[model samples]
Target: MPETPSALPPPSPSSSLPGLRFAFGTLTVLPVRVTRWDRPAARAGMLCAPLVGVVAGGAAGLLGAVLLLLGAGPLLAAVGAAAVPALLTRGLHLDGLADTADGLGSGKPADDALRIMKQSDIGPFGVLTLVLVLLAQVAALAEAYDGSWAQGVLAAVVSGASARLAMTLAARRGTPAARPEGLGAAVAQTVPVAGALALAALLTALAALAGGALLGTYGAVRAAAAVVVAVATAQSLLRRCVRRFGGVTGDVFGALAETAATAALVVLALG
Candidate 1:
């Protein structure tokens, strides 16, 4: 008898969600269709970053509120607030942050650095980076916790939005991923300047609504600074990637996002 052809596997769940598609487009080390967004799509995606931020922030705020209601100490509340975003993103940034630390610290050739990052095991650099990142995040949360719950929520929103904006900047400035098809391509094709500006405005408005002049100014400054840092860092990474592997990768983008978010929150807290 003639054999029937094998059935194709079902499409992965990631193929369904726009956000997940975008995330995969931005973070995966493979090639992807980076050219879906026209100006509107770009704006939509950029704006979506803050929307995700708002959702994540609201969750963090709720977590903090519940913890407080349950008689958990301020420290725990702060930690929970920080952990919520990390958890929501499934520690994507944390992994990026860790890989970045290991890659950059190794001082090996770019290929070696990328290889180290791809390794499943965490290195000394990864551990140290995680500690520093968590420490900074915890301190920021602790400070934000002193204010009203609104302030905590605002902090979470600003941090999340600013990180995406930072990623946009990186996408613009950094080299494409080696594969020519993954997140790097999609982001480079889709993310636009106008959308980033709109996100900034939205973040500013949200901060004003949440805490008036003080928080508004602080959030704006923090976000702007984070963007600058993220762009610069991403450029540096891009250069390294090109020199080593001929292009950027998902890991690099993730690292940039996490670094930018952490810096934004810390600055907002300090401010």
Candidate 2:
């Protein structure tokens, strides 16, 4: 009895699968069972957030390709390409964008801005921002499609994935959560800045390689530049959110993602 020792506790279960499941489940309308709802799982979800975009973009791109092959006009194909992700994701990011716009456009104090963002109804600012961004996306994609369907597809996929990368960057360590709880608190400062930067760079490199394989040297350059634009856009938005709203919120994250995606696509179209 004098020599008796305490036993060690069992290790926690791996959260990778649950995190992936949660990411897809929360970020999209896909059927995924999220088994873990704790912070660790939430962090894991954020880490793998970009994968959801890849899947959504790939599916949307395929639909656009099929539409184009079926004699659809570039505009029509672009609409389908834009619509599929919205449908699959239930436009969560779009809704977030709208809320953030409304909040920021109010030009109120930080507390008031947060309150405005939390409201369920969309305001004039929200409506206007959504309309303009959505139009820009479709118009740019249509132009890219006119050049080549493959280019359009690549642009869509790259922008989609890059959008989520912004979220990862925003969540990097030391980022402040906007509130005591909710998505911002759950994921803010969860990712290491170095890890986020590395992941984003890796994504850009992979996109460049794919562009070179599919399109050419110019496409590769454009692809890399587009990533840079997207990341810059995201960081700019994050800075504004922190200055204007006190910290990043779920709505801010949404706004950042949509803004990054739109900017990336615009750059690709221009290229």
Candidate 3:
């Protein structure tokens, strides 16, 4: 018999790079303790989110620029930017969207509907939800593209940051996880509202400084819209989760972030 291959070593922990660990720990894994803003660890993690947004947004923006440069048209650029983020996050939100759709579509009791959501297999309702959400996103992006690289980059960054902010807010509100334990629970309990607000304010100011009043206003509005949608959606989902599964889960939180982000972008484009 062939020998089993050795597993890769876990990532090293570094005090100097607490932000990376916080981001990775809160977003990607289930840790016993999520760093708190009052503590240095939570502050470090808070920084990680915006940094990730900037890097991811920049890359997506560059791809959009390339598509435009190649004469691919605004629609293509929109699609590419949207697709890049989805791929980067490995469709985490999309999966949540799908699950939520399936749960909601069943018309069954809350418990039964949630059980359906927990199933790994996608249902017909999930497929329809995915299609509609993607269509809405593509349409919004195509309309927003104005043949300007700066706008594209700003749009990407704002969308990403706003979405992450939504997630942070949801966690702060005590949305429970469906499973007994996970990163979502830890994040919800650990991240501070003040830090999130501060980050949003700083990012808004930076956008205004970099892009002028109109651009800054747009970013601010987008962020606000994202927060509203996130909060409302989280409340609705949390209630449903409580009725069914007795609490919220990491997946629902991811779904809330994606939905809010997409809605915020659409609203910004329309404005």
Candidate 4:
């Protein structure tokens, strides 16, 4: 039998370096050099996924702050804030959100839904999902920044990191791939459960501390709440995908990331 992605060994010390390169090269438009593309490298890449989120989120936060300083106002600043990560990631997560919507909205058998997701054309479901989600993200960012630019920046970073952390959780051992080939198969069930949980906890603490530093007690509490909700939303989506589509596809991962980010932003905005 062919070795499955789940069968790949845990990432060793030497593989960790290549994994970092692979994570950035594949997940973002950062001009990083990736010399390894095998399963071990991909697994390590999954472990390093949140680091890419850190870079992307940090840049977005910085850009939003600069725009605010330039008198761009919250709305334009929000747009720029939201647009940076999308452009940097080539809107890869958005594409996943669209595809997942299409698949789920098809309301067909698992096989049929998977087939729908594989189609390159965007469906009505996809169009609507993208419109609503993007609108929510922009609106939430605007509101969060209305109070303070520092709060907005912290929120953006938390949302991005939270979303990537969701990916790490979903990829935890035993999660199945929706198909036998493609990106999903290459990464499915690659993350170790214990390691992912530890990372998630660490990120939550760090985000809360940063939020409190930037926005005070209320901000820290709200930030932590947002991260919790975001992770729950992502996990919920992953479960639904498993039941509806037999397992997770690359699109599912994308959808989780986008949904988690939006949820985090919205929670921070209103909480």
Q: Write the residue-wise lDDT of candidate 1 on 36-126 in tens digits.
A: 4332233234335555556666777678767767887667878998888777767877887787778878888767887887889889998
Candidate 2: tens digits of C-alpha lDDT, residues 102-168: 9989999999999999999999999999999999999988987888889888988888888888988
Per-residue lDDT of candidate 3, residues 1-271 (tens digit): 2111122122235432765556655554334244432234543564466565555556676788788889888889989988876776778778887887787778888678767877999999889878887887777666666637666766676666656655655554344455545544444434455655676667655544544543566555654554455345545655665566555666676676567567656765665
> Whole-model Cα lDDT per candidate?
0.60, 0.84, 0.62, 0.88
Which one wins by lDDT: 1 or 2? Answer: 2
**TM-score of every candidate relative to the true structure:** 0.72, 0.93, 0.74, 0.96
**Runs off by more than 4 Å, candidate 3:** 1-16, 24-47, 107-111, 204-245
lDDT of 4 by residue, 47-89 (tens): 8988888888888888888999999899998999999889997
> Candidates ranked by TM-score, best first?
4, 2, 3, 1
RMSD of each: 8.5, 5.6, 8.2, 1.5
Write down the RMSD of candidate 1 (Cα, Å). Answer: 8.5
The TM-score of predicted model 1 comes to 0.72
